[model samples]
Target chain A: MQQSESQSTGAVGARSEQEPSNGEIVRFDQVVKRYGSNVVLNELDFSVAPGERVTLIGPSGSGKTTILRLLMTLESIDGGVIWVNGEPLSHMRRGGKLVKANETHLRRARKSIGMVFQQFNLFPNMSVRKNVTEGPVHSLGVAKDEANQRAEDLLDLVGLSDKIDAHPTQLSGGQQQRVAIARALAMRPQILLLDEVTSALDPELVAGVLDVLRNIAQTTDITMLCVTHEMSFARDVSHRVLMFDEGQVAEEGPPERIFGDPQEERTKSFLKAVLENG
Target chain B: MNWDTEFAISIIPQLLQGLVVTIQATVIGYVVALILGLAVAILRRVDYIGPVVFVVFEFIRTTPVLVQLLFVFALAPPTVAPLTIGISVLGVHYAAYTAEVYRSGIEGVAKGQWEACRALSLPPLRVWGAVVMPQAIRKVIPPLGNYLISMFKDTPYLFAITVPEMMFMAKAIGTEAFRSMEAYTLAGLFFLAVSVPSAVIIRRLERRYAAV
Candidate 1:
């Protein structure tokens, strides 16, 4: 463990001096995040290559959602750094040293990342069209006419063209989540984080939201980092699955390897429990 | 000793003039309170000065509007109109209360909404203006309407500072006519007429938005 920590630090230093050597799009080097006395993520080291789809699956309190939250900058890290697209995300280089990032730095780094929440978090006051167009028109300065057109097209992609003028409060949970997906995609983010995007939906509604996500996976090259319990969906869409245990990755490989031939006792039991429950 | 219809009718024109001033004061004062209160609520979110703003607003809220009006009246130059002083003082005094209303409204917005705004990388101003304030203001309408009614009633307190509002006119008519009952009764009727309907409208709005 000590050797791995040193190696991760050395790798971060080398990468900071130059471009990301392996062309990894997102890298977490010795990142530590804690909530009061509880350490949510401890020296977590991982990286996602561009256009790769990675899913995180584990029991509650294993820091699966925390990882996505960190990447989205919803919560600050207690230690180490997160690099997105070869630039420091949680910190900025100031006078040749890494320092905690300010709001300006975080805002700039966050523009390339978009997140969809479990609760669908669509602006209740806005119509579906405005919900999808808001980030593009207001944040990115996209023209209103172009943004509206793009919103209509994206709603069509999510099978919600008819509901474009409907308010989010007027839609079903499944429909709202689809609008949220379209809203995130409207920003044209290079990285998408899904934090239990369907966990709040009813069982019947879950499949519809999952199908929208599956369609996006098939059609877009956007890198996805998802935290979810939908094992079958994870297996189908994920290029790699990381099995988390105690805030660290216990096992990581192709979904088949992790599910069919798990090496760790933790991984074997977790998969057995999940598969049995399903 | 007797109810006099002619004396009451004679005072109507003078009282009407006072009613106009009263309405003008209430409208202008309420606008100032709404805008200034929102500014206070937003400013109180700043880390370093938030506590200071909170304490200052608390000081204003705890004191009576009568004392505040008298204090401002005394401090102002004589050139400033008494009505102007009344409007400014009443506006600021009620702003202290409205600020709390806005603070609760802002806090009532869900945490997920803020996270979504940040995730979209919306600028701080845009986040508050487009997302937070719209939702917050909706939830606050009923409470703010209640404050407006309270503020209208409070306009009579301006009489202490010699502003010619409704109560001020009633008092002047009583002094001139030596009959206090009719003028005072009419002034009370005007307040009831405005306040009751406004309260009903506010109740209807609350019921409607609650369903949303």
Candidate 2:
């Protein structure tokens, strides 16, 4: 079951890297982020090309998740500019001078991106149907009937069709996470940020969510920036795996090379910890 | 002073009339209190000190209800009216308490929930309306409901304002008819008749919220 999915994902990864590299979907130019005196992302330079699947793997507090959050505009970048789909996302050029993107600009840009949190952050008040359809109907200006149809289809894709009427409380952890994935997909975002999506699920439920994500990575055109601890899933689904340590990319390569023959001591140590613990 | 006979006949009608007035005050005052309390509670969530609202809430909660009732009722003219002032005082007074209930209920919501709402980039007003308020309101149902019943019981205090609510009517009739025992007893019964059922509803709401 896993091998065939991996094969298809490998093909998709190959295609994305080799395709016409016209417009970069996301670019981070010398981004630096800090909290109080603690620096989380230091002089980070990364770019996610259109249709690429980039997996960020690192130990806790390595700022892998922070990168994703910054892109989603949940965290402000203390220094640097981010360009999304050729438009500056972090700052706007006002009168030929750069200024921070205000709330209105950020909201408009963020609407094009969807994030799946590790905790699955489903709106507890909404049933699965409402959760999936809210973004599309409200933010994307999709008609209600069209959004409902899309929601049903996405629910089926996540293998949670029966849960559409159920509240977040009624679903299992994996089921709720699946609903969350569907919720993000509803907006038809240009990029999807998965922050350790399966890390919070139980062992038995992990496979189901991973299955849905594998399908997305293979079949969809959405650019994905994923931070995950699942090394095997990362290897199977990622076009490029970036190993982060101390808030910078310690190593980056195609998954096969990164997993098989890591170049950096920090990368080797992170892999050893992951393997020894797994 | 035909104690038993006068008490039995006059007290029943007077108590009944007083009971009606008491219930009206309780219902109206509680409704105002609940709404105002929720508003104050939500306002407190704002990061800014919110323009002396905290002071006003503290003032109401700290002051004695009897004094407030008298001041509101006696000072206000018929144009302003004792009934309106009386209910406002009761509502705003207990609103301070209800505000606490709301704040606690809001705090009870997991931090994860707020982060999730932000992740979705829900507009601020919708974030409150769609995500935060529902959970906060649900968590607070029990305590707010308790306040409602307590406010109902406190309705008798409005009598000082000459509002002619249940307690005042019973006291008046009891003094004039010289049947204090009967009138007071009937008044107690009137309170029980309303408050007991309201208490039952509050308990049921508490249980339901707890189950969730």
Candidate 3:
């Protein structure tokens, strides 16, 4: 089951030279993560294909966001290896045994992954243009003028072109989040992780942010693994949806099957609960 | 013996010269403190050697700046001047306090900001330089300004090493001309002159940027 699932993940991004064809963009091979005595991800196995939009949804502590955090390398695996583009993210092979990867290794692996957080964590000290331009100019060593142009284009894409000079503190929450979206896309990662990106916004502000994301989903071939409680968004934008239960994927299928005709009792209850609350 | 304008006018040049020395020591020492304090804060935050760095910072912060000055001055080479030693002592001593301020400022930054940098795969240096310090430094400015004022007032301790700072010249002028009242009053005025305006500026800055 796991072998075939991983093989399917490897067959995406056929158009890109940087992204190798038939290589899983991200894979969790029996990954385990623990915080002291509490096991957050229990030997989980999952895979996300290049350009595929996958969403993880469940109750608060079901470890859905942890899946995104782990892929982004924000958290480490306690056991098992996580692969990004068929290379280990949390561990490296040495002398025929798996060993923890070093900082250099983690840094190299992290280049292809970008994450947008729930809080729209824009650099409060920087302007919108600077926040978007910083990663490419600093980390990727892109030319300053080119980075500025790209930032302008991205800010336009997110509908924040007029607000580029404004500091994060000066913008409203929705505008700040759109700027953050532009900031993440400026890095041009093959994989983007969205962890409840609109959860922190006011109810009136949520639609604007969601529209930006849905537009990105329709336009970009960037592989996205999102964790959002917005059920309609999961139904609208995702190619596949996985319902997590206590650190493991309890139900997984295409959105129509998962949301329309869930097989598991747990997934039905979760979807029902979310809709009732919404 | 009386409050004589003639004597005060005669000694004004020496007291002004000493005032220059005092201002120089404060500016130079505060710069050192600011830079060294940031370095110490970074050392404490980074992995490996945290406990040892903690102990070293605590020791420097708890001890008297005057005592540390005397000790570092005694151990100095013949080539180094007393002014330099006094400044170094002032810097290292305040560095301990500023280190704590920096740590809190850095900590005051939301965890999401740090996570954002990690997600972007920014190098550790960029994380601190571009993402972290900009936010942290804004928070630390007010406290650090207070320390600069504190260091300025404490420059009198440099008199113990015969650096000829303001207080030293004041005492020298008093002992020589028996005009203790004018010399001491002039020295006090100089200190208040520098300290009051700076404290006001720092307060205004705090109000201006505190929203961040």
Candidate 4:
């Protein structure tokens, strides 16, 4: 089943110059993470293919966001290896040993993965244009002139071109988050991680950010893995949805099957609760 | 004795020179404190090494400033540069207090800030340089400025080592001329001149920080 899933997602981007076909963009092999006796991610096996949109949905503390955090190399896996673009992300093989990847190696690998957080973490000291241009100009070493052009294009894409010179505090929460999305997109990452990107916004503001994301998902070829409480948006935007519970994937499938015909009793209870609350 | 005229005349050059030394010590000492304090603060935040750095600074902080200055000055080799020794002793001593100032500032930053940085996958250095330190540094400005004023007042202690700082000059001139009143009064005025305005500025800065 995993092989088939990889193969399906692999169709979008070729793996390497000589492979003639795309390999997995991200693969987690029985990964586990623990924090001082509390297991955050248990022996979890998940994979995302190039250009595929996968949304993870579950209640708080179900470890949905942890999955995305681990992939972005923000958290280390205690038990298993993670492969990004078919290379180990959490650890490296050094001197016939699988040592943890240091700062430099992890940084190089992270260039291909972009994450948008629940809180829009714009640099408060910087303007919108500087915030958008920061990662590409500093991390990727793109030239300033080129980075500015790309930032301008992204601001237009996110409907914030007029707010380029504005500080983050001046804009509404939804606008700041849209700028964050544009900042992530500026990196041109093969996989984008969205961790409850709209959870912190006002109800009216949610739609604007969601609209920007939907536009990106439909128009662009970038792959995305999102953890969200927006069940309806997840159902509409994602090709596959995974429901996580207590550090494990309890259920996963195409949105129709997962949302409409869930096999797990836990998933059904969660969906019922969310719908009732909403 | 033409006390008023002679006092006013003596101050024109000597007091200016002493003011120059006092200001120089304040600037250099504050800079050294800033750099050393930040280094010690960050070093103490590290997991394994933090305790070691904290203990060293703690010792410096708990000990008397006078004793610390004397010990540091004594530890210097006779052939060593006087300015280096003077600035180093003052800087290292006051840095202990500055480190505590910075630690509080760093802790004042919200946990959400750290979480946001982690979610962004920022390297540790970038986290400090861009996200963490900027906010932390902003918070401690008034406290840090207050430390600068305190360090300025402490410049008198350099007199013990014959470093020829402000107070040392006052003491030397008074003893040599057998008249303590005018020289000491002038020295007191110079200190008040620098410290009084600085204290006011610090209060204003405190208000600014409180607003933030």
Question: Which one is best on TM-score?
Answer: 1
What tens digits encode model 3's per-residue C-alpha lDDT throughout A65-102? 88888888888778667778866688655554446788
Which is better, 2 or 3, measured by lDDT? 3
Give chain B TM-scores in order. 0.97, 0.91, 0.94, 0.92
Cα misplacement distance, residue B7 of candidate 4 (Å): 5.9
Sort the predicted structures by lDDT, highest score first.
1, 3, 2, 4
Error of 2 at A164 (Å): 2.0
TM-score of 3: 0.90
DockQ of every candidate structure: 0.75, 0.40, 0.66, 0.34
Off by over 4 Å in 4: A1-23, A95-97, B1-17, B45-50, B75-84, B103-133, B172-186, B206-212
Order of the predicted models by TM-score, top scorer first: 1, 2, 3, 4
Best by DockQ: 1
State TM-scores per candidate.
0.94, 0.91, 0.90, 0.86
Reference contacts reproduced by model 1: 0.83
Q: Candidate 1: lDDT of A270?
A: 88
Candidate with the larger lDDT of 1 and 4: 1
Q: What CAPRI-style quality would you assign to candidate 3?
A: medium
Alpha-carbon local distance difference test for all models: 0.91, 0.83, 0.87, 0.82
Write candidate 2's Cα lDDT for A34-148 as tens digits: 9999999998887888999999988899999899889888888897677788777877655544567898788788888898999998888889998888777666678999999
Q: After superposition, how far is residue A30 of candidate 4 from its true place, in Å?
A: 0.9
